[model samples]
Target: MATTHHTNETPTDVASNGTAPTSTVSPETLLDYYRQMVEVRLFEEAATRGFRQGKVGGYLHVYIGQEALARGFLDAFRKGDKTITAYRDHAHVLFQGGDPKATMAELYGKGTGLVKGKGGSMHLFDVENGMWGGYGIVGAHIPLGVGMAYSEAYRETGNIIQLYLGDGAIHNGYFHESANLAGLWGKDGMCPCLFIIENNQYGMGTSVERATANTNLGSKFDSYAIPWEKVDAMDLEAVIAVAHKAVDYVRETGKPYAVEAMTYRLGPHGAADFLEQYRSKDEVREARKRDPIGLLEQRLLDLGVTDEEAMEKIRAHAKELADEAVKFAEESPEPDLSELTTDVYAPETGLI
Candidate 1:
């Protein structure tokens, strides 16, 4: 067996290296990232509170600190561009034009949800906005996104597919197998898939160092002959800049590309796990100081586009929106038992 080690002394930095891309946008773009990050941060916090208060139900995975990676990538793509991700998907769906009320209703298992109360937190689909769906099986959707790329290329559409997976999913055997196929497709200039690895330091409580031998994940794509890069998922500016470049590269070449986004989950792996034992309190605290939302808020103030009071107002507003979602969800009625037999098949015959 092969092994790699990381320590607190070691940077373990993927995008924080001095050579990573920096944002060169005007004040408006910086403020935009700040506003979106704050919005997502508050959204997740409110989601968590709702889950605890019994307003939101089922398995809730809060994308608390990884807002930059989600919103940054969403900003990089144009409308009708496709996006697929794993079950840490609330942020992705929301960024892809999903209404807060419908999303909240889905979490509440109400008839008004994005899935019409059919799929809960883990399974969300919005074909209208091109979100596709969030798969619960780990790494199962990798090939689905690649297949979408192939189909689109066949149809001569200019759109592209962005596939987001967590650090743990990267180690799954399907990841390597699907990557091999995606690379082959890209060689023919017919693939426009962006494989993003959201490296949040742990794969369900197992630290990346403890879990995998080849910890330099970006280099994995190197061996696959795919153009790849690493980015600071904690920094909205850096995330957006790198994602823009990667998306453009794939669009220009009609080839596959990968980005390893370095971030921390900040919340437990899911609602079921308290996420306490695997990491130290000091470590989480240190990571919080590098919070992407906080970083972008400071950047906005530095740019003078917004004052501290204004920024806080944005945060408060995001919370208020989430509160409204909770109220909408709580008041939603449960699905009728008679309808459980419907939508399972094409035929309208009742179950025996």
Candidate 2:
């Protein structure tokens, strides 16, 4: 009989040293991480409110429980690197140094928003900050992200693409085709892309267990010859530790890698998914116990690095920032009628 003794251990946990990792996050970094997580939490909450208030149009998918995934993975992000993901992309943009006001304004469909409100909530792009854009179609961006990495490899630019996709995409043809090409090109050291699978346990309402035959998402990379691993994404420190190594591996080898971030989404899939028959309330309450912000706060207290008063202050400031972003979105003006045809195509040319 096969026996697994460490089923409860996080992927980043030391193999020989119990469940506690040997590495320690600095007090300064811990505090900053807290600020980032809280801000995302508040900002996403505000966005949800806006959606309910009928301010936002199109599909709305906020990154509520997935903030730690962005906070940790993007910590390894270097200048010139590119990031592309699906619709739930606000957190990635903000963590990539995107402006909160602009992001929120986009959700509100204002002209001053990112992409000038042309690409609402689902398509926020800030190329200067290394974020390609949030795509709406499932598994569709896989090929595009791979192509971007191939471009970087061809130019010898030493830049990689952090291609983020949900677990659901792995079951589709888009992932298979794109990953196969990435593997073949990577053999020639021509594809430097890190595939981050944010496995939030559900693809819409269908759980991974019900969808996947093997259920080990990372091992799917083996079929395409890509090395892969899993990370405890809810633990921000753990994720950052593993992310640095993975980021370095792709950069040095100019090859593809995959990371299945084992995390859970603490909120409904979208604003309208009220009857969450897919999961129970008890399941959600238990997951909340491992909330990244809450975990970090407890860790800080255990280390005596920060007091409760200071933690409250940080949270207060996060709320202030969230309030400011919402206000900015509310005050911003909608795109004018002329915008309908302005960004639809390339400029007119004499020869054409």
Candidate 3:
């Protein structure tokens, strides 16, 4: 997949993927929601800086503009709730309460990383946060999330699993298989999972319109009789509200729900892919007009958050934390090669 990179743009364009529009939320909620978005943005910027300075290694995907949707879902997630996603998973890790330093160290392939540096930028895990490691294979992790939901239900834990997939995964065979199973189990009150589609308008630079025969990704869940809706990814408050509702619905009904978040990537799939031919700079600039962080920031200001100094302090603090994460990663030790032979098999390994 071709990737594109662009400079940050102000006043990003905001759009909704749903058929019906949602009502407005309070300003106080908006401010808190924006805070989450800002944290994600600052963290990504710091990660990018780390990558350029060689403090971080491997393929890096920065979730700068799409922070609102991810953070919103995190805010809605309950304790012991689970989350899973693909290679583009840094933001998801942070939202799941994984230590930022550990994640940075993982990117640098340091043993202090979340997965003991065994998994680089693509694989982040913090089981305590109910977050499984990011899977490299497209759509492969969907079944894991579904199975987790099944187990949670069987154990009567009342926990919900949030399964995230990129626009590209929707076309994969695993996607259909997982969704069908999720729907079947959900109908019988055996599944407690939320299927979240982070449709950033591109599947590795291929516009959703160009690649999808059924561009209405949210409605596709109807075939399985699973309830679903689309949310405006650019608005943090909107996302939080929608996510809260969805989470509540799934928890109460013990069913699976799908939410399509309409957003833009605003960066290449990774640092290596120079996105040029796929999307124009002007198009990126237009999308930037609806940048989620900026939108939420303005909403906070409108909500009587007159403390400019405090806001600056928050941003600065986030940047400092990111810097510390980079330092930790740089100083952390690498994984020993000898340990690779260990943890290779479970107690009941069918084969030696």
Candidate number with greatest lDDT = 2
Query: What is candidate 2's lDDT per residue for 250-336, written digit by digit as tens?
Result: 898999999999989888887777799999899999999988778878877887978989989988988998889989989988888
lDDT measured at residue 69 in model 3 versus the true structure, 0 to 100: 81
Using lDDT, rank the candidates from best to worst.
Answer: 2, 1, 3
lDDT of 3 by residue, 69-138 (tens): 8877766676778899988898888766678888888888888888887778888887887778688888
Q: Between candidates 2 and 3, name the one with more favorable TM-score.
A: 2
Report each candidate's C-alpha RMSD, comma-separated, in the order given: 7.9, 6.8, 6.9
Clashing pairs in 1: none
Q: How many residue pairs clash in all the candidates, one count each? A: 0, 0, 9
- The lowest-lDDT stretch of 10 consecutive residues in candidate 2 is 1-10
Better of 1 and 2 by TM-score: 2
| Candidates' C-alpha lDDT | 0.79, 0.85, 0.78
> Judged by lDDT relative to the true structure, which candidate is superior, 2 or 3?
2
Badly placed stretches (over 4 Å) of model 1 are 1-20, 346-352
